[model samples]
Target: MTYHRTRIRRRRAAALLAVLGAVAALIGHRSPPPIPSPTTLARQLTVAAGDHFHREPGSGALGTAGGALPDDASVFDDNYPGITRLDPDLLSALRRAATDAGAIRFVVNSGWRSPAYEDELRRQAVAKYGSEQEAARWVATGTTSAHVSGDAVDVGPTAADSWLAQHGAAYGLCQIYANEPWHYELRDGAATQGCPQMYADPTHDPRMQK
Candidate 1:
């Protein structure tokens, strides 16, 4: 009876190991996305810049609508509605940060986004992630996205993000997500109280649920 029990335990352990091995193999087979080069990012920004004022056909919904930013976009560039439409306090803070940024230029990768533009992005995210639940980690619906409400901005290149991470609190701009280093929002008392803790991702944010 003892020998039989021992054999049963061994079989269970072997089955568990096989399952674990299969799971590991599946994970290992999934390829990570390629990191875009700086040039590629700049090109995408240029495309976004020119796409301003686009409208979604048949829906009467504004797509870019002057809300798409360019690679060389500055905080003070009000010509683009994207920059001009940001929450007034957040825009002010960004301008101040820009002046003091020095060699690290604060390039606005994205600012305000039209509901139509946001919806399109959400669709693309869902496609890329293979499900809305997984995509929610990166993109939110127009009603839930801070960008659509002009309360958030995505700054870049890598140097600018790093600079903002270090000195943004002084201007009340705070990174809200641990996963997106370039995304920032205005925190009213951050200049004095320091920034609050970051959410793991948008999926973890209470604001995203609504």
Candidate 2:
């Protein structure tokens, strides 16, 4: 009888251990991986989206031109994001600057674009410019646009140009290219000194950049 009792106890202990192991495995499988920390996200934003290397001699030169995108992609002006959902600080500064400047209308040709949307833009730009490099200097790869990280904006109108040039540094907003008078970014000069990471892939949809 004592032997029988010892065997039964051992059997129950083994069963319990097995059950616990199974449960632990299930829990581990169900949980998704943790998102990168804020620090890492900030770093990614810096490099992925910053404007340091993207700078060129004559960006924004076509602000006065109708349709922000190349003629082919511009066919869908019906598509770009509205001015309201852009970076809070940049948006606010634009409002202030626009209001102060009086009649300085800022044209938000694009904002918070998705990677997929960027891809289409790239396609149209490549068609127009004949090369990705040329298109990149013309617009942006979704990954590199300050707008991808919600830190940049495209502005139109020459009146705001001189104003932003003088005050943009004060508010942390800077132009992506010298030619494009309308594009602007938050100073975050420290946030992306060497241009840490692109906000998203140039081919990414604005929605997915985040």
lDDT measured at residue 20 in model 1 versus the true structure, 0 to 100:
100
Tell me the lDDT of model 2 at 199. 38
The estimated TM-scores of all candidates read 0.72, 0.48
Candidate with the greatest TM-score versus the true structure: 1
Report the number of backbone clashes for model 1: 1
Model 2 root-mean-square deviation = 16.6
Cα RMSD for candidates in order = 9.3, 16.6
Backbone clashes per model, in order? 1, 38
lDDT of each: 0.78, 0.51
